[model samples]
Target chain A: MINRPEPILMKGNEALAEGAIRAGCRFFAGYPITPQNEIPEYMARRMPEVGGVFVQAESEVAAINMVYGAAGAGVRAMTSSSSPGISLKQEGISYLAGAELPAVIANVVRGGPGLGGIQPAQSDYYQATRGGGHGDYRTPVLAPASVQEMYDFAGLAFDIADRYRNPVLILADGALGQMMEPVLLDATPREVLNVPKPWATTGMKDRAQNLINSIYLDPDELEQHNLNIQKKYRRIEQQEVRYEIILGDDADFFLVAYGTTARVCKDVALKARAKGMRVGLIRPITLWPFPSQVFDDLLEGKGNRQLKGSPKPFGFLTVEMSFGQMVDDVRLSVNGRAPVYFYGRTGGIVPSPREVLAEVEKIYAGGAGKPEKAGN
Target chain B: MTYEMLFAGFGGQGIMLMGTLLAYAGMIEGKKVSWIPSYGPEMRGGTANCSVVVSDEDVGCPIVTEPSVLVVMNEPSLQKFYNTVARPGNVFVNTSIIDPHHPALARLVGENGERKSQKEKGGGRAVMSENVSATEDESVIAGEGVRVFKIDANRIAQDLGNGRAANMVMLGTIREVTNVVEMASLESALQKAISKRHRDLMEINLKALHTGAEWVRSHDVPLLTPAG
Candidate 1:
């Protein structure tokens, strides 16, 4: 018989921290930020009990550098911050990526472009998926929509980081970071994946010293390193595309969203379906991979019977909490095959399901065959 | 069943705690629940609110835009959210701090679905003349089908000892009126929300809850089951 712990109500930040700890994360360093302070606070209280180290660094930059240092020594290290604080950690993130050190950085996003409000927003989609730092490097981004996903994805992020020897980011919004929900913790203990880091900078006794540096002074060597990094990113893109498709069998149109916005889109889909309009949702779990295959399949009329016989046209409505960021990727995937409409609310405003449904209805009322890009 | 509840009041009024307890109770009963507090920019002592959504199925959105039930523990919250309640819903007002006949509530209709003003109030209802007159059933129709529950929650808590448990009283009143969660589940949730260090305060809180429930029972308001 499998003994599982009962579900307990927990904030998303606390759950994510606990999930990381359970996955054998031992070192944490983070500066305080609104909507995500709970992560560091939880780590401060629980890390010592597990024989882990938690450091409240003086600044976001210092915290991320500390993570880089710890991860260099083969420790599963992590750091978290909000939007502005995350901006301060970009250089360190680039260093981690360039050095091929495994680490996790969580961003409980707030409004962007500057030191924006502390309210929830998805303005960081572009920054997260498209490498916020200055490099020819890409960090795999996991977007968790619910509190459960926030908990489950922490370990997954760490595992992905270690698997690729690259930094992995968990991109969440203020809402997902602050919300509380019940989560069932796995009671049975399991081994953390046995991935030995032979290249860790532990010691040089009886072995060649491991050099963990991103700067290659020779141009040829630098070019070769960049090529290897690009190859790894391509492999990750092929193998790590994650998304959820809901009610799309006969959907006449699809609403593409992620994170908290996707949850709202789910409700909008249900409401539209109840009114006899066939609506669906395509929620991208991996924002970096972007789940382009789902869009490709839908455009080919694979699942929906209506689109097959007569080539009935269908459109994609991309809803976000930012102004037309993810829509660009959706357009790239659609490749102008169908009209892609964009609807967004910015500056810390979370669009309501009613408002999003109105947008979907508007797109439905209009014929879905056009190939124009509708921007909002 | 899905219940979207919004609890709003001053920061120190335990508004967040009230919503958390409801969410916890719903989770204990094997329901999917989400609770989100408003962490926007605000000054100290400013109004605070939290939204809790409890559903038998998956919770689509944690933020409650149109609430099935709105609990206003102060005047500002009522002024802020009275109109946002869904039609055919319930709004619980703390009459100890909020005037039942305040100008902000002038547009709301009476319980019988008539637009009655303060001047149109008839004779011989158990009116709290010191404040606004308490209605016969202690409720007023706020919208076309929305019922407003007016209870002096502070006075009820004071009567039971410890006025700070007014939030608990309001919780019990809402529980009795809506039956959103079982009483046993609520008791367990209370234990979870409060810490073991302050376990001694549980007795008064339980008393406050019962007192609030008794107030609802003695007033004989209709059952306001949560909207789907």
Candidate 2:
């Protein structure tokens, strides 16, 4: 009998490492960065135990290149870094995208423009969703709010990356990276992790040689490759747009948030409802592919049954740790059908629940989330 | 009840660990917890603090603006954070490091505890210790019947032969005061918090906790339950 598992209290970064290991990730390379240090720290010790390779590269750029090399070897590989470090890996990430390398890159983002302090910030939303590096492509971006998601998404990221033959990004912020919560260490067993990769560059014995490079010398060939990547992105957008709509059916106003910000919004939603205000939460799980359709269907009063009380929502208020990066997506999807307001805190400052609630109250008091023009 | 706490002290006093240990212990008890350390220049030298929230329900906003419990291991942390405690809140001051009857140097003004009249420091970040000078006032802030519990955690840990485990001493008082997690879980979490190489110091850590908890139990004035 497979030994029954017991839940253990774990930090988010550690859970990511554990999850990656359970998902059969045999190679990890990254330089240490705060908030994400625990991931590499755990992997350094745990990888040897699992007969996996863990490399502490000289720099973030070197670390991501190591990930590229490892993934090119047809082994499950990953790299992790914080905001500034992630910036260093952008060039490597762009290369991975061009090469169509199936790899997972986790960025436990911190505040930034330039080494902007080591506190958590969701400012990397645009960086993750819209391409961070010089590229005309997209990487599947997963935002995990809790430690459980941190664990669960690690394996899922590798699968998605492999399935699409593209790099995947786990866009976690410092708050989620550092928080501790109860999690099942290994939900996915070793036997279930045997995904096939025919395009991997292994030692060419009897098989044809495989080349892992993003270079297309010909303009026509490069254009064609870009179009093909676009096709894959379209397919991803169609098939995958995961989100959770909590009691938004009856809500006169919807609060859109993700990760740690979503938790604060949930608390505000509860408080606002308790005070007889119609407030609810809608949290997006997948940052890329944007889950834009969920908002569209909700606004149109389509198949989503949980939106019970109101036939349609008044509008959405996007809450984030950054100064309204994801809010643009919310507005793009809502498309003027309903007003959308943005409340955020950038530069490593975390918003309190009460601070978010006060904003919610302001929005609600402005007459059913209509959001009377600014300063009105 | 949601248990929100702020642990504050200098860089190496294990202030952050106190919050982290509570968070871990809460997780062991199947509770939700978020531990957020002050991840700025303040962590470099002068003062370090972290906010920990433990709740049976989901925790929103890991930043505890007005914590339900405030544990101060140093005088600067006490001065910097004293007023942020929620009314009818519990404040644990380490008498070993902070004088009970001390007046803050900076003149008090607005409601938000923003101190004015400060000199430049580290690119104008306004170091908390430098902003507030000392006074000889004998008015005790953590006096009787105010829900402020004073304990000599430093001395308690020193008595147990590990002065670094003063965080554990403060944690013991936290267990007794908050009762957010079980004592057994706290003890086990403390054991795990210590590195394996220092297993020899485990006994003394436990002793320090017990001693601190005993002092709180014996000295703190009874807390009146807030009526719903």
Candidate 3:
């Protein structure tokens, strides 16, 4: 383990960069983009100091490919971009997943369908967890709410990527990337990772030349590869459903959210509790795993008998900084056991706590959320 | 206690710097801080502003819909945010650059102080008359009760040989009025926020802080006595 430095205040972007460096991320390739530009800026200055590599690639596509190259050489590598930039890297990310290469991609996402505004938005939930580019693939997406989480997740993304032999993502947004806060950055150096990858494509001098290509002309071989990836994903879903329950027990209703939206919902829950409303909150840390069991547990209770001071157990309100993406997962988890409702703000517009509370009140009063388009 | 403040001014007025320094000072005080800069085309020459929240507990969303304190360094900034300052909050209005006699301003002293010509009095309390008519915006501001500390922050900074230090003057006033962060920690934050090349201005900036705090102390003037 390395020395833990004194706690320093930093923007979320800078913290992620420092976390990557601390996690022994020796290679970083990324293009310059707003909100998340600080990641590349920090890496450019610090990577060389640690005898690592940092490149401001020509574009997002080139930058992601650079990450693929570095990861192929069995080195800790990373790349970061905002929404549009992440969109551009999806093809490369899909390839990374197919090849079973381990790499970290930090998506400090912004509002978007195409080159959307730079303000924070969690609209990329579907793009991140359900596969954005092509084919059968899933990226383990970790959402960070605070600057501290941004730092910790940067390292954790790399560790999980290597451990699972998959591409991992730090799925934060512009708010989490731009907002500044105090972060404790000391402890648990990257040497503890110590992931052995003899199968990695290093030099062929002492061992068999490892092939690192996604293209499998044989249909049966490709199908087998996909089945293997799916099996690993199932394992991840079973073992890595990280979430936090805020005042969940004995509460009447819950606000389901993630990342910055979760922070806002926490305020709403607290304010509602102050007003004698039994409101609780659920924050999903791993977006890819989706924490369906958490939802299932909350929805299932003694039938017909509601808890005191609360609505039905399954009557949960999903608040997202997007136009209702995660609510689909929430609804799926409930599966008619309990009612699921949603409130969201898209196009870089953040929902205030007051508005979210108002929506939750509506839900508690038997309002049903109009389900949106539900395909991947 | 959580203190949410908005520091606003022209693009070059060091408004963002003031907010950053406050957030950093909050960190020095062992408090949780979130600094959210208003990022858009509006920040160029328009009203550049940033919201800073210093809290003992974990901070929620960083955006300040209604700030508890406001440092308005320009007329546009004042006009833009006066209505959004929460009642019972504090406002430090920069009288140097803004027209105190501006018809729409809800001057703090007009109700209690003697009305004098703008030429005779450097401050603008005459607009307190609007507090009577109470336009919707003005009603939200003065009618709701706010301690308005009208200071010639620009003039004070100029007197200190750096007109740009007006933001610092406003910051000092915030420190005195809200006591959101410790004075010594603010000074340390100032040193860290300023670059080595501008280390020479550290003393003058500290002077600006003292200058603003002194102005607030002497204002024995009604900083807003919350409306009953």
The best candidate by lDDT is 1
TM-score of chain B of each: 0.85, 0.78, 0.83
Candidate 2's TM-score reads: 0.88
- Pairs in clash, predicted candidate 3: A252-A310, B146-B224, B147-B223, B147-B224, B148-B224
- Per-residue alpha-carbon lDDT of model 3 for A75-172, expressed as tens digits? 99999999999999999999999988999999888888888898889988899999777999998999999999998888888889998989998999
- TM-score, chain A only, candidate 2, equals 0.95
lDDT of 1 by residue, B84-103 (tens): 88756778889899997665
Better of 1 and 2 by TM-score: 1
Model 1 pairs whose backbones collide: B127-B134, B128-B134
RMSD of each: 3.8, 7.3, 4.5
lDDT of 1 by residue, A298-346 (tens): 7775663423432333778889999888989999999988888888998
DockQ, all candidates in order: 0.81, 0.47, 0.66
For each of the candidates, give the backbone clash count.
2, 2, 5
DockQ, Cα level, model 2: 0.47
Q: State which candidate has the highest TM-score.
A: 1
Q: For model 3, state the Cα shift of residue B163 in Å.
A: 1.3
Model 2: per-residue Cα lDDT over B16-134, one tens digit each: 77887788888778887888777677877778988898998878777788887888888889889877777546777787887754343122211123322332233233233332222
Off by over 4 Å in 1: A1-4, A302-313, A367-375, B110-143, B222-228
Error of 2 at A4 (Å): 7.0
- Identify the runs in model 2 with alpha carbons over 4 angstroms from their true place: A1-4, A187-193, A308-310, A367-376, B104-146, B157-165, B225-228
